[model samples]
Target: MSPMTRRTYSFLRTSRFLRPHIIALNKPPFAIPAYQIRAMSSGNPTSKMLTANPLKQIFSQESRPAMGVWQMLPGANISRILARSGADWVMVDCEHGNINDAAMHEAVPAIAALGVSPIVRIPDLQPWMVKRALDSGAHGILAPLIRTVEDVKNLVTAAKFPPEGKRGFGSPIAMQNFNPMPTFTEYLQQANGSLLTMVQIETQEALNSVEEIALLVDVIFIGPFDLGNNIGHPIIEGKMDPELDEAIERILRAAVTAGKKCGIFCTDGEQAKQYADKGFHMISVATDYTLLGAAMADSLTIARGQGKQDKPVSY
Candidate 1:
């Protein structure tokens, strides 16, 4: 027999327990029967199966900052690849990506399976959008283009279920995405506090209402490009525009004063590090499209006899 065939046989023999749960494509990955899962896990009802929100723990404690990448693609395969690559979280960009509700349902579980938080950036602050994303087991929601305290307040309400807010829940696959899956009752109880509600501080109105907005949401996420554009500076490559710098610092201060976490969009690891140094709790280091494009461009340059490649700037 071939050596590779022998190795495959050995692995299969050793992995007998996984055989029953293994599923084919064109079906939900967690389609393992409930009885089988119960048999595999302990029979104790008090013993929960998953934690449901790992990012909640990370954010609650003020230890090391969280790092994440933005995913603008639609497939579960792309999300799975990035999740396994060691990012603390993955922001699935439904706002700008061609992703729809169906695609998000596929991607969330794939990212969560790798123990990484899957935060969906909803296109807008619509209640239905928040409900769909949350029902799909998103650890959090990132709302873009937030301009007023009312916007953040409305988003928080849409994200939480009463008596805190008014979000209706009805997803069968919800708790499965968490690590130590909770009971149905526990999910309703813990979800409101655990799930993050982040709103963008980009436009002038948002910056002006920064203090009030900070107090209303779990996180104040800065959209640097929009903020720069609103301020009429428009962020430039490697150039430190004083006006833009002041605006960022103002938002950061507002969040800190309100005792809320802060997040920002960063283009690369180096920029992410700088933001972290400024005490931002979460930083998006890169995006899948940006990384892919840069790699493809580099390869093409080398093929054309170019010695080195220049860094990419996303504006």
Candidate 2:
């Protein structure tokens, strides 16, 4: 017998699981194996799986801040276009945006399919809202108006599965957005650990318990406009009050001390860069509505052949 035939016979003898199948076919010992032929027939027989969350991957890079955009308009195409803009994450703003539950459902998969994390900013800290957001395959839930440590705890409970929190599972479509599409079992295994839980510290009550709340959530996001208003230091004449600035710094400090990520809202890239340099882990660079309005206004000014008009101030 040839050496190659002898080796094939040896391999078949050793592979007890394949021996019966191979023998039943009554094929030549040197003939190509069934497994090899199957693998060859299947184009790119390699499987792809998610190793980590996209936002988590950004956060893991030391000194690199995650730049995000807020989606106030509700459309899957709009969400996909924004995701293609190279933002690390996109906030589907249900809290203040025109997005309803149906729109959110459409936007989440669209955003996620582009490898950008879709973080849903729910209208409130209600558990049902949290459940709905998570069930839609959101990578995270940003609960607005968190007022206490208990609120943070409850938010976490609603976002996680059992043994960590009380969230229930059974979404057949949740895993569809993931690249190469993980099985339901794989999705369940990674969901709790991969999903981020964020609470917005925009109220005076939440500010007072910032430190305690920071310890419970993965991120402490500050809504500067609402925070200033809630704390009786609303931004006046387009200028931030020193008191509001101090409160913002305090929240940043609390988040840092607790070893949690800190995020804030900014109107432009310059403002986002400033916060990023100030040790904020996540920063929202702009909202969809504002960007569209600003771009159109600038375009119209240029078309009129007028001296560049001063940009309007926005929060």
Candidate 3:
């Protein structure tokens, strides 16, 4: 048998559940049982071999929306702290945050090692950016400012592997986060289905094609601030425009109709909870920089003998 086939056989042979099925069917190792494939593809929380992506596991197992935090700062130590703080996922914000390619590489494994799925928010829908984020061992890539169905298609093509997409692969460090990491062959076989492909609906053009775009990606994420600005209803003086609210609802409805997950960016727990209650699948509760500033400000206010008061700005 070829080395790749041999590796597959060896991996299957080690699985007590699969060994009997393989022998009974007299099938090639590549022909995994339908149930096993489902377990792997859907990230069965009970399946040891297929639980590499914590975000996927949470999506499969939990009824509540996956709560996430945005990482604007650029340290593996900071990433680790966020990962351990009860978040289901941590977004390494490469788009607008201080995180660059090198910092992304540093953050992914650190976050993943703590069992939190590290999602990288790339600056744009560029193929090279997708490759870099995925190759760094991220559980997902969130591309910002996607404006067309073709853009969604290109994003999917750049994120997936052969037959499904044209993404090229050769990352030696990609599987380092998984406990008892799978073989390279196993990682390659599962990465496409296991990793998330999220695209942002931030532009007016994107809002127009939201339904079609929703059908293409794993998650349809809303950038509330950008969406408002692009649609000529910019959130002014901390107030949400009714027209922006309508656009956000339209995007949510489109995602629901497409049977796809919808996500949104929120400034605080209260805002995140409101979106979660509206059936958003994923919600970013806060950003590192903003949270830090807010906390400091609150502490100072208390120190100065002023009782806690709500911050008016929403974005």
Candidate 4:
């Protein structure tokens, strides 16, 4: 076997239970039945381009080039705002921020209308939660704190359907964008095909097992802040320590070896650039709350600079 390429699951290092599931793609009752269907975009009159689905289209090319912003506002509006801002994608921050399933119920659809993919960062690997987000019409899924091959396996099962994984089957509901009245099979092929899945490898354990984990995922969106915090450098935003830097390098290299795209979430332009140069193609530059806070701070500074403010500069 080659050094970097280990025939991809060549050795039976995984447990028997997992080995069965690992081969889910090739196994019975786990394969997604492929069907040739006419491609359909969301029925937005303004969107004339041909897209199978908004979310799946992002991964059409191997690069999956995108720049997203997380958490733009307090309510569901952030998704739409980020879309309007021309972001290719945006992740509703349920893992760290206060985005519950109910919140996603309201936010995801709104974001979709704005012509950008809305990915959800779920709190855990609960299949129901992942299924809930997908059922609720999520364009993509961003699972946080992925640490092992087991984690990847669970996510795969949760996110995909049979012959691939064990995602439940339901074609029409308020969840699948309520295609008014569509058959179950019709919804399955369209929605599942358009689904995009991504995972974060931020924790020390995840960083260590990232090579194997990367093999199980399509994209690697590194969480810099939480990763640094996990490594004892909390709140040292935009600062790079050698150990952390090396860890980040290892992650990127692993993604390359695993044939996956690498992405980083940072709240600064400089740090974004640093990771970009390090081979991160898809990245999120800031959060919803952070953008507002920074703009507020800028306003305050400018106001304070005005020596004699007769009244607040309101325009």
Candidate 5:
């Protein structure tokens, strides 16, 4: 028998004692009233979020941590390497390292094409730089110099879209597949979740407020050199200084307490492992330029050792 039969309709039409949902199959599930409907008709909200975020499941499931690399390789091929490496994420350093939009245009899409998350570390927490990186197809932004919770709030405002942020919408941009017909309402809804905002907590002032900063930031990356400097211990000391180490520990503790992902750069694999063990999920291993310089110096040293005295190179 047809479920929506004339008799059923007549009964519903004439009766007021019914559940008001006699034709329950016609109702939408997960609605305002929360009525039960066909299982296939509605999608799970948590599952949808998980499907959208690769790291969502990682953070939810057992302790599978993510390691990041600060790949500043030129010509934009950096993205492909990160995508194929099965890395949890990567950062395109446009900060103290050498990078420009000319390079970012190629790198951002290349990274996106490879399906690895590309985080752009802008030179500063400038709004234009933030917008430019996003418009170029970056999935997240790793901004630096977050001294307090107020700084985090400001950065968050810049990273978000209308009512939450001030990012200028560009539907014609390549990020939307260059779709010229994106509805503003639909685009705004997607932008909030699709975009990830991160801020750095590397200074003494920042460390003092690390707990508050962590609570406000989505992801946090540490500037090791700057951190050491801010803590009055230069990296030239050649080892993790006592105060700097303690400060890092403090930040990690606060981050854990706030349930936010903490990140920092390691001088090498061993250092990275140390930080990871200390409860850092998002870790930046090395920079492409630094790796190349170190490799070349090591190769030259090896060649010289075969013929003459060895002398290590320095920047």
Candidate 6:
């Protein structure tokens, strides 16, 4: 029997009490109350409900940590390169990066083509921005400057679809990210729960409400640049400042307590490893621009040692 058939048979066989209420096995899955179905499955104890999104599956497994790249430049080439770089996901930055709507449209597919999840970081908590990101086939959203629980609630609504949220869905392109593409109804049914909502806790206001926000979103991401700046320490001498470390600890505690994944921005692999050691579920290891800059600088140094010095190339 197929998994669905097996589940159905198991539910009917084990849930003798539910048989009286359930019309028939031929009835649609939606016909049964969702809670009763959950109860039946929970009672069975052998079945597992899995998330369809590739990136989310990383967090679903406890031992596997998620490592991602920050896409600063626009286009499919950059996105494709990063996606195939063995990272669990890629964060296409629309907020800080030069990516616009046009670039995102092209970039998301390239990322998905590599079977990697594309997470878009929108500039603000605007619904239109969230809708545009989602419509472009993004698997998740990283919303910055989330200052309160209310902000998180609105962002969640914008990210999710009807019944659970108010996000309007008509994107034919969005399902392209799914492997063995699902029908629109199947996609809609899973979309609200599958897509991740990562809220950046950067400001003092956000830090204060970290516990509540942790309960609201899937991931609690710390924007070190903004967090340190707002905390009046500016992340000078790395993110090791006592005050900033305390704040990071606080946010980490909140997420751990709420049973949510925690993430943070890192400047390089070293910093990323440090945070990962500290138990961050997700880590943005490095950005395209930073990698490129370091590569070019190393190449120039190699050329200089070979006595092949020519005119310097300026950006």
Tell me the tens digit of each residue's lDDT in model 5 across 1-315: 356565665675456664332323232211212221122122243433224444433555658567767777766666676667677667888887668888877776676565566678988878888888887767678888768777788887777765566766543343432122122233344555545678887788888888788887667777777888888986774566788778878877887888877788765666778777777878766667766777787777678785433333221
Which residues of candidate 3, in runs, are more than 4 Å off? 1-50, 309-312
lDDT of each: 0.80, 0.81, 0.83, 0.66, 0.65, 0.79
Which candidate order results from sorting by lDDT in descending order?
3, 2, 1, 6, 4, 5
In candidate 2, stretches whose alpha carbon ends up further than 4 angstroms from where it belongs are 1-52
Cα lDDT tens digits for candidate 6, 1-315: 578977875686467664432323344344544543333212121121124477777777557579999998998999998998998899999999999999999988899888898999998899999999998988899999988889999998888765667888556678767664544444555676677889999998899989989998899999988998888877654435788889998999999999999999987887788888998899988899988877787788787785434333211
Supply the TM-score for candidate 1: 0.82
Instruction: Report the candidate with higher lDDT, 2 versus 5.
Output: 2
Candidate 2, position 313, lDDT: 71
Please report the candidate that would top TM-score against the real structure: 3
Candidate 2 structure, TM-score to reference: 0.82
Candidate 2 structure quality by residue, lDDT tens digits, 1-315 = 789887877787668765543443344433535553333212121222233358866765556899999999999999999999999999999999999999999999999989999999999888899999988888788999888888888888888765577877656566666665655444554666666889899999999999888888889999998999999999876689899999999999999999999999999998888888899999999989998988888888889997566866755
Who is ahead in lDDT, 2 or 6?
Answer: 2
Better of 2 and 5 by TM-score: 2
Poorly placed runs, candidate 5 (over 4 Å): 1-57, 60-62, 174-187, 298-315
54-157, model 4: which lDDT tens digit per residue? 54455554454577788634476666777788777778878888777778877877777676677788888889889888877776788988777788889988
lDDT of candidate 6 at residue 311, scale 0 to 100: 31
Worst 10 residues of 2 by lDDT: 40-49
Residue 72 lDDT in model 4? 33
Model 4 Cα RMSD, Å? 13.5
RMSD to the true structure for each prediction, in A, is 11.1, 12.2, 6.1, 13.5, 11.7, 9.5
Model 1: how far residue 204 lies from native, Å: 0.5
